[model samples]
Target: MRAMDEATVRHVARLARLELTEADVRRFAADMSKITDFVSALREVDVQGAEMTLHPIANRNQWREDEAQPGFKREDAVSNAADSEQNFFKVPPVIE
Candidate 1:
């Protein structure tokens, strides 16, 4: 893997719409080089027998027993809205 140079860092900054100074370019170049080296080193690790999984531990959603409950009236639901039309809350129209 090639080390990240200041020119590459400057080019990347331009692509990202960033305005970086010479000092920032130097810092970023070194940081990016270190990151690339670390990622390259990771390629040396072997995981041939490892099992693939979405998460490290098994997980599942828990649900409580369903039961009927009292509900709010339509008037109560729309009472706090800034504006309302009939039984529903009214909102400003959006135009594109």
Candidate 2:
């Protein structure tokens, strides 16, 4: 079984841009260790003829057919806009 240490957990947290307190780090370390142990146990399974599947039951893809449709006209669309220009929505600059 794997044992994920506090130092490893803190390092990973930093890499993922997470801000964890000391208590969080210690708590997560023990949880992560157990998770790793479970995954390690799964690696010892024997499945010589097992078929890979995303779910236990068979699945099917359901999709709607794509179709073109008429949309709002430019004049009528922008009529209610508080501010617009040349058939386009306009707003103040977000960045310099």
Candidate 3:
């Protein structure tokens, strides 16, 4: 893969609303180039017939027997709230 260029870095910075200096663009381009090289090197690996392994741990769906359990009281659940009204926790308004 070709190394990422200054133009591409500058374009990306603009899209992200970043104010990158020339030095910042050059540094980011160098880092991106190294990442591209690593990915390109990975593409050359032989994985034919290799099963796709999702997780490193081989254990699959080891679950305990489901049973009814005691649940927490409503008051206990909201006991630590800074503000509570009508049996529910009240939080600061987030949206206008």
Give the winner by TM-score: 2
Per-residue lDDT of model 1, residues 1-96, tens digit only: 799999899889989999998889999999999999889986788978977788988899988779876899899999999999897989888775
- By lDDT, the better pick of 2 and 3 is 3
Candidate 3 segments exceeding 4 Å error: 45-96
Residues 2-96, model 3: lDDT tens digits? 98999999999999999999899999999999998888987888999999888898976777779877999889898988999877999999899
Clashing pairs in 3: none
- Candidates in order have lDDT scores of 0.89, 0.88, 0.91
Model 3: ten consecutive residues of lowest lDDT: 59-68
C-alpha RMSD values across all candidates = 8.7, 7.5, 6.6
Alpha carbon deviation, residue 96, candidate 2 (Å): 8.3
| Global Cα lDDT for candidate 3 | 0.91
Determine which window of 10 residues in candidate 2 has minimal summed lDDT: 62-71
If both were scored by TM-score, which would come out higher, candidate 2 or candidate 3? 2
**What TM-score should be assigned to candidate 1?**
0.45
Q: List the residue pairs that clash in candidate 1.
A: none
Residue 37 displacement (Å), model 1: 0.6
Question: Rank by lDDT, descending?
Answer: 3, 1, 2
For model 2, state the Cα shift of residue 90 in Å: 15
Which whole-number lDDT from 0 to 100 does residue 5 have in model 1?
A: 92
